[model samples]
Target: MTAVTTRPGLAPRLTALTKIVELGPGRLDQKLLSEASTLLTRAGDRLKLSSEHTVVALAGGTGSGKSSLFNAISGLELSPTGVRRPTTARTHACVWGLEGAAPLLDWLQIQWRHRFARASALDKGESQLHGLILLDLPDHDSIRALTDTEADRLIGLADLVVWVLDPQKYADASTHRRYVAELAGHEAVTVFALNQADRLSPEELAELVIDLNDLLRREGVEHPSVVPTSAVSGRGVDSLKSVISSAVSRRRAAIHKIEADLRRLEQRLSQTMPVGQALSAPATVDEARRLGLTDALCDAVGVPAVGEAMENVYAERSSRWVGWPYPRWLAKFRPDPLKSLRLDDVSDEIRGITTGSVSAQAAEVSNAVQALADGLTAGMHPVWRTAVHRAARSRSSQLPKALTEDLTEVAPELDRVPGWWRLLKIWQYFLVGAFVGGVAWLAVGLTVPGQLPAALQLLGDSAALPWVGLMMASVLGLGALSGIASRNFVVLGASRERERLEREMRRRVAAVSENMVVEPVERELGRHHAFYSAMRGLSG
Candidate 1:
């Protein structure tokens, strides 16, 4: 993968991987993650089994002399070498140290009959190779599928691999492509042995070595190790031994293998999860989308309709209390704005009450919510955008009842009487009383022609007719004029109430939108940002 002078430790990378997998549930490729998890678990189990013993497998395709190399290294013919179609079918393991190696061998699935222990080989100049477990694996390019499969499995478990190649098979593009190139990032634990070198002249041997090195360098190795070895002549065997000894001495082959494997996996994840825009803080839903959602909710719940209703209901109430006393009772005949929309009562005060009120059309609400999701996740990956879309609409089922409850809490009081209306009513009542008294006195004089009260005797003499009639006309006209003048005040108050109600409705609708849409979408974006951040740690 990535080159850094000093990288973050294994624990952090492992932690980062776990974070990525956890946060990537619906928005990442699960198959890729599953393989990473399996590799981690398997690597852990292998590391726990043995670290002192380095398990190095000799792997090569058909007729590559892998068995001969194994025998030459172990100083014994532990593996059978043959030629028809498939040779070295079963794996043969030779362990230099038997102490703590049985468990590792068992885990590798090596049969006891095919395993060897060199516990007494200290006197054969093999002390330097003390902690090594060399394995001769089956031919990977065998005609028999079973042998090929066995070789592939064992080679994957090996900490270090020595691939044998002869003159004929050194340039086999298909073989290297299928095996060596696939392990591109694992150059630290790999070596290619150019075996059977006795067949070529000195000049030809040098040319073959140059050609083999060139081939391997093309497969992602800056400087490939191609040791020329002849099993019969024992040439270049010491060089191969030196490579194995260095790995065993460090006792870090197993750790290196896991590290390389992790890099490969992280690279795979990087391909799918684009390194997002540099995020300096936790993600949030933008203000434009938030406001848009609130506006939509206001429309959906008919805030404008409610505002109009408020003004009508307020004006009607005002007229009932302050109108001319003669028509005061007739105000009740008008329709109440709040009651017409079925919004006066609290929606959930009683159980199982459904709202019959009109709201903005369903399509408008749906489109608004969709727009919010689209704007919030504008440049996100398709999978993450899908998650944001789902989050935006997650609570859509509760929108209707929520809007109804909010409207109920903010609905204006229809029965409330203004403080000044009562004063106006009393003035009108006094004028009406004066008109009634004047009418009664005149009527008494008319019916009983001369039987007038002493105080009203002048009005009965027919000379008081003009003054008495003027007095009654003045009281009636004053009451009517007062009622007509109050109309302007009533209209002004109603308009103010309508504006107040609209403001309150918009505020409550914004709260509903924040709860149902904006918050959920932000949470999904937060998850994406967290995942992206962790992946950056892996690169470092």
Candidate 2:
């Protein structure tokens, strides 16, 4: 190959390709990614080797005369042509200069016998086509499997492709659908040769060229080139050679091929995913949404219900402790609200087990979680939106267990009883005892009225009986007043305890929300951010 320099600005593009392959799988279609995967693997090997020799392939279907064109271009019968043979079963290479081409040819997997070097050009001083390696590929529509296989393999690796078509098969279905359409946006390194044009009249040739270009346009080529040619008469042969020579001299066709491949991959990727779509998504949950989620989860985990149960428990226990003696036994028959729901006296463990009775409706939890995912991923690309939503749902099945465990840990905080209740209990018992004892003494005094009245009169003269009666009534009234105050205080304490329980329970449920939903959503957004950043580097 010639000592020409390759194009600049290619290393960065390759780096961009590396970024895409590394970050694509989780966010890209694997089938589409397979194209990038093959291209990237091929590009790396190709870039490591020589860039001076621009490999161009002449590819077409059977009876297209591409083999004839290949022989005409080489000025030698390198590829045998016949009606029975139909197509080239294997690839044949013709190189203008042989230097630095062995490694490239080896990489192409071309056999040694099929290789040809033009030594006559050196003797004749025809150096115009120097450093060019033209490949005669097998027919795309050949009945033999090896022909199609070799054609496909060579077509993908070639730096530039020269499609050799004839008047009859220029718009063939197999050629357009399988090959031409696949190379849609790669128009830069593509050339179309309308071979066997001598068989058509001048008007027909011009019209065929127009029809062929129109067909190429429909296949996604922007400015399709249809060079009319005749291998028998050498029509457009020099023009095809000139096109090959121009690419060889500039030495950018290899780099341009990679660039075109990258563009095509990027275009297909964008069709499925809008570029920079992740940039607009919300990365952090707002305070309002956080509160909303916490509230929802709190309900699902039965935080508010537990808190209300806490108050009922606190009040019920208070009745046995501070209630007046006459009615304190009634509290024993009442069921503790907290115990009935299996939240009574939770163990002081981080992973306390609670019953399913505490859970809210399942649909309620699902809606809340979905809402949270939707809020965070607004305006995100479908790829990342799906990822974020999936992340949010990744541990959703564990939510009921997580919430119950967290609620259990927080449940023990409500069981603490105030110390004042104990002191009040002693005071209430003393009053009940005093009141009962005084009534019993009065009844016994009535049985011995004469002695009791004489003893009372001796202690306090004529007013002693009425004064003793008034003293007994005063003691009864004081006990009643004390009982009323105890009831009021118990209610106040229980209410305060309920409020405290709610706050603590909300905190635990919030922790559940973070693990089950918020954290996953954030992690997904992080992936999207990285993916988009890599895409930006690629676009540059």
Candidate 3:
């Protein structure tokens, strides 16, 4: 912390960070503004507590001499230093006296310990480094996962990090892959310390230091300060102390930590803000004005003037349900006279909206309703109905999907009607032909005198009349059979048309409902709605 003025543009950096957090990237800025507000609040808290002492954590892997260096920096063997794989289990917090820093310590859940580094215990030279909270964290590669977790937790809260490394493991693949690589851009608040330099000769130590510095530089550390030290010989302890004091004096590490927090907050804010394409509301009933479905339905049912015709038809039909039939003039005066007639003709309007053949439109609407209900439910719990309106708003697209699904749903149900009806109608003609033939046979059998006179009554009181009656009976039976056949055919045609119309109407309705209603609502609620609402109950 050499008190060198802050690398100009601190304000701009703060502004950019605020923008990023408040409104993520451009496309989703509006969506993330609220989240940005939350992050900004946290940043403000951190800034408001500027009087707090900065926390600089010492982080490293097993056998990295972090404990040894921690002792050297604090000028006391506070941490157990040995050849074991892991030395520190719990964290050791070394606090320097500074006013109004208690809140920060409490936030970190750290137990305070006085700094007692002597001014004479120097390799290069010892210096008093005040206004800093130094932490010696547990080994990142400790055998216990808990130790690693502890180190990571402290690192998140620390304002600066001093990464301690042994020459041999400095370039360890795991170290670089997991740790150094992630903190590349965070070099401002990070420093590299090559510990155990006593292991190498002076020349070798100097060379190793140069190589280490070069390695850090490649990892985005511009002019990184790499110090060589040995707890056994007190090699570079003084220089390390001086460096720590300088950083503390200038609060470089503190600023860097705040910047990092800003970056993180900004990233989070982006999520809350709107960016890119503007959100679109779902299509409404009015939007399909150009579809002309209503007109189409009116035309199909042969009632082009549907609006007025519907009123009259309804009134006419309603007139039938009432046992006390009203006079036509009187019925006209009744409220909703159309209801009295039961001649509501809005089916055509329904047909038009469905946008298909009369039959097709009916089917579409039926299918749409079924699908919308199914989709609105599906996996949803019973209690989920409470959030339904919100859910609809969020998943606007779902409305359309449901509608389309229903359009196809009723087609199969209506198809279940038997196909034999048509054959019956054809059978009626054959029966009529048989009756004519029978009559001719009977006339010949009787050998009635000179072709029975026109319309003359024969066999009146005659014994042969009984045989004629039998013949007539047989003819009548044949006619009855023909009648049944005809009825079947006629009924079958009507039935088929009825089913077709139903299906068409249902499908059209579904399409309209989905496009006009469901899609927009779902889109709006999808993002913020809790996917697993507890109110959904045990079923959920």
Candidate 4:
């Protein structure tokens, strides 16, 4: 198993694991297991098999004498000892094949074997050497570098690894940096041996092992095991075998590997959790509504009638989003926007609130909507353009239709006035003009000799006038008066009619505006609320 120990608390670990599983099939969680897990599983399997086989795969750079060391341990030269870059291609497993442990070997799938039943071959064949399965892997630094890859793969699966080094090149930086440093976590399952030890004296061999151990310690191996041996003279080979036997008997190395692997898995699982504890639940509908979403919706529609309804709803549900704790007197201004909702008044007051004050709030809202549409069209897709065009056409059609329909509906109301009132107003102007004209005509008749003043004519013949002049004066005066009166009446009637038509048009336009524009806007605001809520949920 990996070197690190798991932190206390099974609940958190299990929670982490559950989250890892929840990540679905794409996650590679097994790689997250610690080396400890790997060691534990290997140990458990070995115990159940009733076998003490500790497979030690010897792996290192080319000419590291890995195969030679394998031959020294097995005592029969099972592997070719060479100075070539790549020593082997296929993996070579040397099993002890112990009695009553056949099932264990079968489990290990090591069918290829070398038997040494007699005492003579026992020394020759390396069989029953405390039930250790030693494998000689290819060189890691070979021209075919993938050979090293296979060696590493086998090392992960092995119970133990005897990393064979040389006296001259034992301190090779490449070997230590690339392989030894990485195996620091598996110190229990790994051992470093200085091969070709015949080149040095006993004291030198001891010094070298001490130095190597110190180096391993610095590389994170707290207590590294190091041995000195020579495949040429067979020095210290028996000691190496003994160490392997002791590890096999206890199975510490295998268990440690499993524990490490499991630890790695645990860490990976932990990453998938909520970092420390669980997060609070997602935002609720009540919370969003409290944020003036409904009010915003009403404003988006810019309808006064709907704005009233939405405000009521907002106040009713405000308690859910914001807690209510005050008494009635204190609660008088409890639902204030700045104090509770923290919303902008300008945005909320898109619909006019006053009874009779003229408000261009609807126009303002429309302007805001148009701005938003323009922005969306530029940034998003051309579909917004189509949608905007379609809406404009629809609104254009609806407005005129609503205006004409409302004017028709309210026509009877305007027509309900008494006919006598209209006639009286007409007669008042016409009769005044007619009376003035008649007076002027009689005056003109009197100005001439015989046109008028009949009382004067009876008084004296000297005051008498010509009959022809009276006739001419009387006819011209009557015609001129008739023309002037008719012109004045026509002008007054036309002006009054124009004023009446304008007032009626204003009333009809207001009704149509309420029904056609404001009503649909409010309905659309409701739809906007639903749409935004669904989108928010989907995003979360």
lDDT of 3 by residue, 140-189 (tens): 77778777787877776677888899988988876777777656457667
Residue 481 in model 4: lDDT: 55
Encode model 2's per-residue lDDT on 340-360: one tens digit a residue. Answer: 755445321212334434444
Per-candidate Cα lDDT values, in order, are 0.78, 0.78, 0.55, 0.52
TM-score of 1: 0.79
The C-alpha local distance difference test score for the whole of candidate 1 amounts to 0.78
On residues 157-254, what C-alpha lDDT tens digit does candidate 4 reach at each position?
67788888887777788778887776645767788888889888889988888888888888877778888888888888888887887776665555
Residue 336 of model 4 has an lDDT of: 57
Candidate 3: which stretches are off by over 4 Å?
1-50, 85-88, 112-128, 217-225, 261-540
- In angstroms, the error of model 4 at 243 is 1.3
Model 1: weakest 10-residue lDDT segment is 345-354
Cα deviation in Å at residue 346, candidate 3?
A: 8.6
Residues 1-540 of candidate 1 have per-residue lDDT tens digits of 111111348667767777887786766778987876777676767757867788999988778888888999998988888775333358899999898888889988999999999877798888889889999988888778888888888887888989899898888876777887767778788888999998889999999999888877787666677789988788989899999999998887887877777787888887887776424433887777677888877777767766776676667567766777765546457676447755444222211112435444566677888988877777777787788889988987777667777677767666678778989888888988889987987787677856566536665565677788998898878887888777678988889888888888888888888888778888888887888878886665
Positional deviation of 438 in candidate 2, in angstroms?
13
Residue 217, candidate 2: C-alpha displacement in angstroms: 2.6
Residue 245 lDDT in candidate 4: 70
TM-score of each: 0.79, 0.75, 0.48, 0.45
